[model samples]
Target: MSGQKACCHGPGYGTPLDAMKNGPREKLLYTVTVQPNLDEPHGDYLATVDVDPESPTYCQVIHRTFTNRTGDELHHSGWNACSSCYYIDDNAKQIPKRDKLILPSINSDFIYILDVITDPRKPTICKIIDGDVLKNHDVTAPHTTHCLADGNIMISTLGDAKGNAKGDFILFDTKNFDCVGTWTKGERKALCGYDFWYQPYFDVMVSTEWGAPRMFRRGFREEDLDDMTQYGCRLNFYKWSTHTLYQTIDLGTEGTAPLEVRFMHDPKRPEGYVGACMYSNIYYFKKKPDSDDFEAKKVIDIPAKLISVNGEKPKALNGMISDILLSLDDKYLYVNNWLHGDVRQYDITHPENPRLTGQVFLGGAICSDLKNVEVLEDKELKARPEPRYVKGRRLEAGPQMMQLSLDGKRLYISSSLYSPWDKQFYPKMIEKGGHIVQIDVDVVNGGMRLNEDFLVDFGKEPYGPTIPHEMRYPGGDCTSDIWLANDGK
Candidate 1:
């Protein structure tokens, strides 16, 4: 925190942006972060948090409200293309005036639009594209959402009408919030779609897959492993300008369940990283010079956390690398292993190589790490009869979703992935409840320090224990913000 700025930073927030400003431009104060709760029986909505590091209640939940219909598990979220409006010493065309978030539930058919502009403190649901919108589009289970250069909210679906993972994307108008149409134009088919990132400068976008919606909906099962069609293992590239399929690269067996996709913050940089969940690998891809072809290389593999059943090792390592995010400077890469129970930071200045600089285990499938620590008496954590880590505060669930401040000072962690899976993997998450921990990052030196004082216990909510997943901060965060036009030429 010495030379770095205390404020939140990103492509358009604290940095001297180049794109013109819109709406109430008061230096874009207030760090409003939002995440979805995956509760059943009419209990899911975006959870808003105040993450302004300078404020007194920096990591406190300022406000929260329920959105989707009954049984819809709220998941991933992204901004409404407002990021393209800022420029840094370079004049770039400003995006259409919009200050809302496009949130979609992967388990349900609806998409909820959260308007954070009217009242930063109290975010309200402005509109919702009912399940019927998805029905008409012949797609189901909306997953990752990204803002396009033309201000269209590009949402990738998990299944088709018949529930195959041959998913597609839908577009929404940011100005008035209307379902434009299915983004898929040509017969370009994606076997499965989980997460995608686009670079307008390269006129290219890449997508990775998890599996068929039907398989993942019920959580991880032994049947999924035996069934070949259950999970997806392909990465697809698209010609952004035309929405045409550029190339499809089968990641083979190693890149199973590739979840989150992230590109370098610098639009000109073609390299990026994606988290492979099931196999527990990190695949980084780069564009082949002078051509549209791209290649994905396995750069990192997380050590598997295996369990012994009846004095024998289980077949697979339970290390689920669910979420990965890059710092605004694109020098640091942060990822959380939901199953292994640790969040690790890697220095990625060299695209081919990533150096692990920091790591912390919160407690997960294996408990051998802890045998004598005193358990913490807290609203969110439950101490087992037998101890695990010395801290005694073992996470009831693995780290699910994560969001980093624009300036790369703080990284917020949550522990809910899917409603069904949350129960399957971390059953205690519902009873003990999920928690959000704020970790301080030394951007210049490369390290992480858990800020114990800054913790948000989702289990302590008035509405019973609710699990939290996929969070986004207003203005811009590592995952949500997108650019439309570039530096004014």
Candidate 2:
């Protein structure tokens, strides 16, 4: 990957800081790093890093970097090679070390601040925040972070405490990285799990939580089998100024288990819509003009059985709907059924009622690799389980993360298990290798699907690992809302 020149221009080329500081000023490049579990050897935690795009070939690729409230730099480096830790000096020599800071557990929600760094090159350890701040606050384990339009940072906390499982939102001073204030949704313990995304166009942030009442029940055991009751998902609207919860909609009522919320601005739709995955249904909520509320207008139920390639009833589908994406043209919506191992496209000609127009199955009889491992001795474990097989269909691995090309012409799909912290905790699943399916999108056919022409073998890389969390488009416009400097220049 080193010899290939990045598609975008080299960093630090056109920025105003070109002549300011000493050598080249470093820009934060976020890349998710998976830290393999030494105990089970299969589970790993995903962490992010900031790298200087123009640094010499020999500079160390970073593990983590963040600035405290006081503007002090904090950094974490030096994980083992199996963990994919490496150095890139001017000579590009690969030196490996095990001294890197390893978190106490593999769950994604275990730590508050995993690692931080102020300087991209030669980063230093800054400060670690305590988790006690969430004792009675009903905040979740790991906080979802987003750098706001202002200099402040917004973190969404999922409430998994002894009380109600409902969640809250917190804001921090980016300069010092201190908790400034929080946005609570009344007094009910709401379960706001996983993540929240900001929709700047509407001046509001949106999040979805799987409302499971049993999660709040005492003595809840992992092995307990119970009816999965949908508590109804939430679409929270916040007033950016006061950091207050302005309005919310019960998304799960329209669709079961509304997990992911994505914002879309369409030229045809009077009000933009939020697409959500509710079990076997797809829902869309359109925003009210100049208001913090949305009208739940449309719900589309996916057909249970597609005429299989050989024309048979599709198998039972179970699992969380991981991600939903809209093409640049806003004509179609792509939904990934993680457990079902299928990616489908829907036509949104009528924004309120999208129709499932296309579908493709990449796997069958899905079983999580993380849930299959049995911890024998401290340093050893059993071989990962193979895909579950069923008549006329074999389980394909789950699709965990996906991203579209800027032009929206191609889709990149990845198959990996959930973070090690989830119920199933297989760590080394990535070592068995995963598949990257690239599909062409038909923009002309109301966002219909084109044939998949390429499948990249990521496992063949020299130090290949199990999971690849994100893809970085180097030298792009850097317009992501997380970037503090995105003026669209």
Of the candidates shown, which would achieve the greatest lDDT relative to the real structure? 1
For model 2, how does the per-residue alpha-carbon lDDT over 48-118 read when each residue is reduced to its tens digit? Answer: 32333354431123333322221111111111111111111223333322221212111222322333223
Which stretches of model 2 miss by more than 4 angstroms? 1-138, 160-164, 185-194, 199-203, 211-232, 252-254, 265-278, 288-292, 303-316, 355-358, 366-396, 420-435, 446-465, 470-489
Count of backbone clashes, every candidate in sequence:
14, 36
TM-score of each: 0.85, 0.59
The candidate scoring highest on TM-score is 1
Deviation of model 1 at 109, angstroms = 0.9
Least accurate stretch of 10 residues (summed lDDT) in model 1? 1-10
